[model samples]
Target: MTYPVDLIIVGGGPAGIEAALAASHKGFRFILVEAGEIGASIRRWGHVRMFSPWEHNTSPLGRKTLAVHGHPVPDLAAVPTGAEYLEHYLHPIAQSPELAPSIRTGTRVIAVGRAGIGKSDLIGDPRRADHPFQVTLARAGSSDPVSVVEAPILIDASGVYDQPSPFTEVAVAQECEASVDHYIPDVASQRGRYAGKHTVIVGGGFSAATALRDLLPIAAEVAGTRISWILRNADRKPLTAVRDDVLPERARLVEEINRIATSADVPGLTILRGTRIRSLVQLPIEGGSTDGSGFELSLAGDHAGTLTADHVLALTGYRPDTALLAECQVHLCYASDGLMKLSAALLGAMGDDSAADCMAVPAAGIETLRSPEPNLFVIGNKSYGRFSHYLLRSGIEQVETVFDALPAPVRTAK
Candidate 1:
């Protein structure tokens, strides 16, 4: 029930994999914890592909691991889909000898805190109490919950994919009087849910952009389908999209979204932008609605007049399970854009262009994904520091950074 190692990694997504690879090279022992399957986010956003191509998905450390193990590396240019990840990334790495022995799949880290930082324990002792580590469960889905793994340095690669916060649980939604059902993985596959229905979307970020882009195609094909885009500001600007370069991905994404908002029509598309949601009052559930689902939505807008909708898709944005982060005392940045901020300085430490690409998380300061509690690091889009690239590169940066922070590997007596 208590497996111990030098490094305790939480959340086995791209970040955890990269971190595991880095630790392997340094010969540091580690146990990675994940709540669900390796790539949970991909499962949720199955339809969409990354804006960045393949190059952004592999870590410098990962490519090396591939070569060292005689596995052919994936092309940097091929775009990955939800299905592609399992084949190209996850399957190969899991099969590789690089860090497979160290990884404990299906382990979910519940909570982490200070374990130890004493001198005796620092002398290569794994079992010493107060070892400054992390603890995890064998599998949350199992009948009996048991503590399974432990480690000294707990590097958190747990991205915000598993338990997305609901729309009703925030101050903004309450203030704006908006209602949302965030992170609906079943939205697309569960057709007849929003088809031939009037929908209202709220938010000004990528999630909103995603809704706008995807829904347009659906609306054109489906008759009697109408969806509205909403944001706090009438400008209806989407965060610009840019290539994987350093200069202005932020502005570029925002600007591109703006252009999309201008019309939102790309052949067989009937969509408009510049909409906002003021409030929602659900109608009584009735039998005639799609799949016997009923709930007409009343919406107030920023630019346009009030309208009624069959459904409301509030893509406002997402927040970290801050409730969980606060438990571990993982300090979060108070960003002006209403999102968590990571430290940007971490990117500066990357040596070359390749390293820079790995460290280049979208939002600044996510690279500062460290805790005051030594030997703890964060992985995933959270550590991206600025914008959430959600690429394997960010995860790669996480591993490289954490490895850089660890002590030189302990040699076992032959």
Candidate 2:
């Protein structure tokens, strides 16, 4: 049976763009759909520098494609901020003549399923591969008048950055929900909001560290600028400093953030270890009220009490948006929400002390990229799901593996 397209690639990030490149090289009929402009998510956090340098972040296929189009490559050894990555690599690849016409920006994938079948229709049935995938698409942020496209295969590279985990395991208060900032804020650009104000930052990942790092200078320069860091771990050391780390930037970050937590030297800075925010509410700022314009947070765990802050930064990590593939037969890990097999492989890698360095984790085998739903694969950070250890390099490798496993296109577009 002839399908309208050989594959449907969801997302326009690095992984998605790589998949599109691979498909183009293989002469497959494909379309890459993105909810926003290509690299929209990266553009959102464009200010933050990535730990991995350009050499490790880009794929060989992407590099070749760009070189063929006469695009100048970036210095492979230099660490680039998110903006640099987008400006030098992702944007050029997406705009390359090879991929430009095949991409559809401002389009969001609503759902995916096997054509003419429900989620339960095929159970471990090899014949399931015979049916093309039915993909529902709508304009981003709209639900009216959806359109359907069919493909023999589907690749979901939609990442997790947009779905940030809540500050607390439990449901957050309405006030907290309305007030907190989930993404890393550009402290340099938003100095007016943070200067001389008490800001509370939560989470223990690189994002949290990045926020603290950016805010420390602000705290030192602005009098009355109070900053409180909340960590659920009693260890106080929120970041792990990989011994003799290869990435100099990552090593420096771990050392600096850990030093702040351990020494408590920065004035107006407070680190509350083993503490959790039980509830948060915005305090009314009335004229003459010295209580300040901010939030009152009830705490629990090691530091159980109440704290006040003028701004709250919920730097908690993100989880994959799994709802888009609700109709597909995909098994996700109970813990990471990643593909079951890949999650298990990653979890197994964690047992080794070397795995402490994300670069040390073994590349997941191609089989782990497979799902019960044939011809459907989730690649990139989305494949890692809630797992925080994903590197751009891993996503690049995933694209290679998925394409390697696919058979040659039944018919190439003329």
Candidate 3:
């Protein structure tokens, strides 16, 4: 099934929604695809609220939607809870006439090949099975033949949080001791791919904290599987403080882990605090170095001394999934922070309008969002990777830019 819309949006998060509205006002037809339910993070992390408020989430177009519908404006600076952001804000914005019809939820996009049809002026990597521009979706109701959406304009609003590969993969190889392997093995095999293993996790951010809080119980239930919580910092602790924002959910997570930690009784469940991983040592054997099929790690400590383990879980952090960009052949200027900057500098580059700051990426690595191909552009969190507030502001910048690119309808003198 091939349906060509004016534009095809690959993500339905804050960027996707806002971009749709901007496209609509510009009078270009578009379709939006979301792999999970809309606002996946908000739904998955429903227990917590956003650090920024509702006003920040609302777009110029979004604000107009509220006004036309007779809805009162929300506090601009109030960061909404995850649930509130979804129910009150995201849902509302997505339902605007600007969206809805073209929004295909539960549609997960696999690959975005470089477009040949429109011959995009934007600069970036070339897509694999090139087309004018195509978006392939994995959805239940999709016809037997499957659906292939072709658009002149494609926006890669897909964010990074979704691609949590595996803590093991993210681990710095040198940090592993002679016997250590994998930073977090469980996340690598769990569910989609990373699951069912003695996974080690190390990080001080919200992602690490959430994974630990939720995955402990599941690990305990399984007979031999285990979880080793290790962190490198002053004093033995759970890396960062359990986020107080999630209050009840955070407490529940801690409570469940406590019970499991006490009952698992298996010495296998160890929490190495105040120590850092030294390196991963592969024991040499006739076939290959085999300490454990999936276990091995050596660690060093500031005051706690050094140790060894089967696998290490280093939730140090994540950069954007820039690997996918390689496939698309997108030209990326590396930011000190790893965010990709667009190529074309904005028409209105800067001003006191605060929002205009995102107009052009002033960062070193980030130059412009221009893809290697013409007419191809990226949006959402990806657009604001390093320089600007990676939140929603950069998304707005993308929305307006793409909308402006499309040909506008000429006025008729009555």
Q: What is the TM-score of each candidate against the true structure?
A: 0.74, 0.95, 0.60
In model 2, the worst 10-residue window by lDDT is: 284-293
Residue 8 shift from truth in candidate 1, angstroms: 1.0
lDDT of 2 at 171: 81
Tens digits of per-residue lDDT, candidate 3, 188-261, equal 23532223566676754445555675565566565555667766655333422233333343345445554543
Query: Per-residue alpha-carbon lDDT of model 1 for 1-414, expressed as tens digits?
Result: 233477777766677777777777787776666677666666677566555556777777667767777777878777666567656776577567876776676666665544444333334333433545445365657735577455656766666654333333223434223344454334467567777876676666666666666666667778877776655555544453443545343345456557766654643332334443434544444553233133344334435455666666665444455444443444556541112324434334442333244334342332355554455566665553334335565556556655666678565565
Best by lDDT: 2
Evaluated at residue 46, the lDDT of candidate 3 is 62
lDDT ranking from best candidate downward:
2, 3, 1
For candidate 3, give the lDDT of residue 369: 55
Summarize candidate 2's per-residue lDDT along 99-200 as a digit string, tens digits: 999999999998888878888887867678898888889998897537999988999999998888778756866655767888889999999999989999
lDDT values of the candidates?
Answer: 0.56, 0.88, 0.57
Candidate 3: C-alpha lDDT: 0.57
